[model samples]
Target chain A: MLAEMIKFEISRLLKRRTLLFWGIVLLIALFTGIIEYLGMGTPKRTVFDAFSFSTSSIMPLLLAPMAGFFTGGALVEDSRSGLLSLIFSKGVSAFEYVTSKAVTSALSQMCFIGITLVVFFVALLPFFPMGSIYIGAQHYSEAFAYNEPVAYCFLIALLFITAAVAFNGIALLTSVWVKNTFVVMAAPTLLYMGLIYVMSMDATKVSLIDPYANLALIDVYIPVSILHMVCYWAVIALITHVLAIAAFSFKKDYM
Target chain B: MNEVLQVKSLTKRVKQKVILQDVNLSVSEGEILGLIGPNGAGKTTLLKIVSGVVRASSGSVWFDKSAGIGIVPEQAALLGDMDALQNLRMLSSIRGKIGTSEIKQTLKRVGLDPDNKKAVRNYSLGMKQRLMLAQAIMEHPKLLLLDEPTNALDPLGIIDLRMLLSELAQAGTGIIIASHLLNEIERMCDRVAIISGGKILRQVNLRSTEQTPIEVTVSTAYDWDILKRWAESVHVELQKLTPNKGLPRGILKTKMAVSQVISELQSAGIAIESISHVGPNLEAVFLEYAQLEGGVYR
Candidate 1:
């Protein structure tokens, strides 16, 4: 049943026009470096620099909003379309249904971000060189000199995926109560921006909670900071999913 | 027949407004029970509770767990993005994976095209209704609940549904149909339960042809008092009709067989002008219990 549900969820997500919208966003992300090279006097000298720049700078902006827009309507559409009663009547418990939806949304966002990063890297290879890459503080750049730049790029992409999962969880939780699709789509973006603003105001207090902040430090910590950020975001995502399940289970009225 | 469903003292309170109150009913295997009521009479609520889509505030509903259940709500609950075959495939998985050929056969049984590729969103209201019926019967559930099942059906479709339901009932599947069409209920149900104000007003046994009361009207030469005494001696209720242009008239009400009633009246020496049998039709019984002043019945 779980496998079937996952298949259904994936198919449902793919069929929506939202997938097309997200596909267009990914295309835009893929061509950003070429567009930048044409506009600026000098391009990033190596593929690692271009990949890191795109993953850290542009991916978060696109990833969170895309996850938010799609997750926002994940559960709401079933209720609005009068399919909830049919689903529940067929013996699919609310918990199972919500869990399947949450997992499917998170996995989809992960794949979307993963694919975009791969495309961005491949597209930049012809234009940028594979050479000794400079990262982190000018003085500390040598401290991490032994690590491969491509590996570090992957680390940053993983961090962004973690942040996407957390955002998707928040979006799924919001969908438990908010039936309006527009509100579901806009909430995560607003929340992400709000988190960023708070982190900027007080780095000490908010950095531990802010997913994007950890992504920004990919060049500094190399491995440890990225792992810590991933764990932090994953825990938050799990909590939001548990809350979503509880809210859905306790709900007596599907309409 | 074994009892297939038992709903006891079921009550539903939605945000301080009571929707169903102390409703108790049952259906046995092979029995087709009709739930007849006016709007807001809690017929749909009862079905929802029985189907497990809505939780009841109080009371219990017990079903024969071995038998699968099927339900068709007033609004057909189908995924609009999916085509007809896909919708069945998704719903059929709940009963443990029904094959495509079987689903196609079920659709054909419900008068739907097996190969139609149109998405459910484009289906007309009647087509959607047929699809809903098709899904409900796809698993061959032992208990089926239908709410206003004929809402979008044409005359032929309605007849087809009636025949399908009869076939299911004959095959020993219990059915509880809630509908406003009393004539359909009269023809399809073995028993009819009239519900009003969240309570079942009465359960009429349509199969008990002998138990139903028959009304007898007579134009007689005897006086009203004489006819009244004869009826009283025969253990039947008698009403004296107003004399029509100086002609004596009276009516007799009894649960006896028609032949017995005729013989009793003939033995009483009452001249039978017209021996007309007025019915205890489901519609009359339904109205008697559904009206505002009808009061409660067990």
Candidate 2:
């Protein structure tokens, strides 16, 4: 059953126009990487900040939400297309149906994250030569020595990807719960924005659940604190999934 | 009669709209129960509830003398990404039905190219309907529920489906179909239940030879009041003309035979321009049961 569910989920995702949308975002990321390479003569703070700021904010804001909506839409597509009734009628339980969709979509997004990581590395490759050339031009041979915070940079990127995918899973819960297209798209954004607003107000208890706070903590190398935040997001995602199932089981509306 | 499906006061209200109200009906083994109603008479909603896609407000459905049930909703419900064969495999895998070979043969029976690797999205509406039929039969279900199985079907497709339903009934598989096509029900159903306003208006058995006498309409410029009274005077059962907005021209319902009454009207120097047998050919029975006032659904 899991295999069948995954097969259908992957096929559904393939139908989505998300690939083209993501392709555009990737071009922007590439353009930023090239611009940072050309401006390598600037101070180290400005150079690092240029790439860091773009990767931290732009990728998460624009690409993260699209991925979330796509992940969520994959699960709810059957209901939207009127196929749920057919499968349910044929003795397939709601539990199996929902489980298949969630697992398949999550797995697909995991694969997508892996591909995005490849693109991330390729975009940053050009900066390596540009930085070395700038050091040589300054007539300091020792400064030309290339040493990158490769492990730290890669680790932070992985962390952001994990949180983004986890947040996408929660967004998917909204899609499964609500039948309306507008609600499915808006629900996750609203939740993320609401959490951001609450965190801006106070940083005591609820700050632990905010994925952005967790992401920021990852960048600062607070591994223990980041783990704590991931746990909270995982718990919230589990709870949201349960609620999604409940809404589906008792849902009176037919898609 | 071996009861295959039993429902008691199945009710559902969506946002207090009250889609289904006290809908009670049953189908026995080896029977074709036709469900006919207006557009919003809760036909689709009722089918969804039975199929387990929608939960009823307060009702229970028992199938095959067991606690479980299987449903085939009105719209084609196969996986759009998969071909017909894959769709059948998924359905059978859920039920743990053995033998994919038998499933393949059933697909052949329905005239679907199961080996054709085209996805369901690429299939035409008629082909998809055939696949739906194939999937429903593959499980050898104890109770089969089909909604609008003939909606997109052409002439041959309709004939093929009617023959298939007849064959399934012969195999002792109880079937309930929700459809608006009264002619198909009249020709194929053993019995029918008419639902209107979320209620079951009447249950009529079509296989029975007994039929209520129809009131014949004689379209002629001559006066037929004397003929109407003459038929009534002999206790033949008749009524005077009343204008019906639905039918346009004036009409009446009576137990008088068309041949005998037409001969009587000819003797009265009435030249009959046209004669039509118009006493509710399943459609009217549905309208009366649903109490459809103006449009498709009241």
Candidate 3:
């Protein structure tokens, strides 16, 4: 039963529509990066610069919330459709059901965003040749970016996917009571914008606890290690996932 | 009869109010148990508790999970996006026990075309009800829990449902049905439980050939004054059904056999224009139980 639940949930989260949605989002980000590069006064922008600029700005702004949108109201929708009761009636325990939802939501978003970032970087490499000398701001780890640009992009992709998983969990948590899909999608996005605002305020008074910067890995705040933010955002996702499971376990699904 | 389920000392309290109190009920193999009660009398709650959708505050419900359990809720518990085949296929994937042929057979049994590719959202209410029934009985469960199974079913669909349930019961499935259709309950159930105030007020065995409630409806142009007096003198329970003077005389229900009721009515000098046999009158019995819950007390 657990295996079947996992199969169906993964199927639910990994629809072709979700893939198309992420594709369109990456295309928009790529075009935006191209337009921004055209407006820049420099002609020596490398492939790494294009990738870094797109990942620096658009990933946290769009992909994380889009991840939330893809799977936010799944459980609540199931509750409203009477599928929850039907599934429970079949003897599938609560633990297995929640586990399947959490696992599939995180795993599907990881696959979507990870593939999008990799594709975006590859798509830009031919357009912008790698230069022997590179200069860019907001790279967070400039030494690592210039020396091992590919590794740097993968690390950023890893952090972005982690944040996307956390945002998805936040959406699922809101799904416990808020059945409206728009609110579920908008909640974590607003939080992301809010955290960025709080982090980008007057630098002297700015707090280092910005979740948005933690994932974006730009404008160093407390210089938290890359591994540390990965664990931190992963823990945030785990906490929300746990809360969603706990709340959903007690949610009365008469539908 | 083999006992398939036993719910002992079951009680459910939501907030401060008690929904179900000491609901001790059992369903035996091949037995159809009908639960009839007024709204808020805990009938649905009892079914939910037994179906494991709701937690009972106190008590234990014992049943063999290996034999399988089928359920039909009041509303359609189906995926609107999926076709009937897809919905059943997903369910079949859970246990991986049955194949497509069995699912198709179950769909056909419930009067639905298995090949129809239309999503359940496009299906009519009756079709949805049929699909719900199909999903429930796909595994040929030993125990079936149905709440308002006749909801949204057309007359033909209702007949098909009755026939299918009868077939399932004959094949040794213990069924518990909660419905407001007293006539259907009388015709389908071997036993009827009248519940009120979250308690089982009475359990009536309707299978007895001799003691089964037999309603004798007599159509007449005349009033029912004489029959009323005769009923009072003999201490037989008489109900003045259809008292609109423009209609029939009345329908008199009694525990007596058909011959006795007709002979007694004829001897009472009542002109019987037309008399028809009817099932036991549960309306008054249900009202009697409802009075206990402050439902019909005047």
- Model 2 reaches what TM-score against the true structure? 0.78
Off by over 4 Å in 3: A14-19, A131-140, A177-183, A190-207, A211-221, A250-255, B220-222, B241-269, B273-279, B296-298
lDDT of 1 by residue, A1-255 (tens): 566666767766676775657767776765774566446554346777666655555666776678777788878878766566666556666777787798899888888777767777787789878864454435343333225665667667787788788889889888888888988888889888887887778745555655553234444443335557778888877888788878887877666
Better-scoring candidate (DockQ), 1 or 3: 3
Runs in model 2 deviating more than 4 A are A1-57, A74-76, A122-154, A201-224, A252-254, B65-72, B77-93, B96-104, B115-119, B211-227, B237-281, B290-298
**DockQ by candidate, in order:** 0.29, 0.34, 0.46
- What fnat does each of the candidate structures reach? 0.30, 0.52, 0.40
Q: Which model scores highest in TM-score?
A: 3
lDDT tens string, model 2, A1-255? Answer: 555655655655675566657755765764675565556554453333344434555555643465456665654667766677666765566776777666665566556655665565566565543332112222221122223334334444555556655656676677766667666666666777777787767645344544443244334332334345546555655676666666565656546
Candidate 1 chain A: minimum summed lDDT over ten consecutive residues — where?
A137-146
Cα deviation of B98, candidate 3, in Å: 0.9
Worst 10 residues of 2 chain B by lDDT: B242-251
Question: CA lDDT, every prediction?
Answer: 0.76, 0.65, 0.76
* Ordering by TM-score: 3, 1, 2
Give the TM-scores of the predictions, in the order they appear: 0.81, 0.78, 0.89
Better of 2 and 3 by lDDT: 3
Residue-level lDDT of model 3, residues A1-255, one tens digit each, is 778889977655543355686677677876696778668776477887677666766675676568667767777677666677667767777777877888888887788888887788788878888852254444655555667767766677787888889888888888777877788778787777777688677664343444333233445445565556667888998899899888877765433
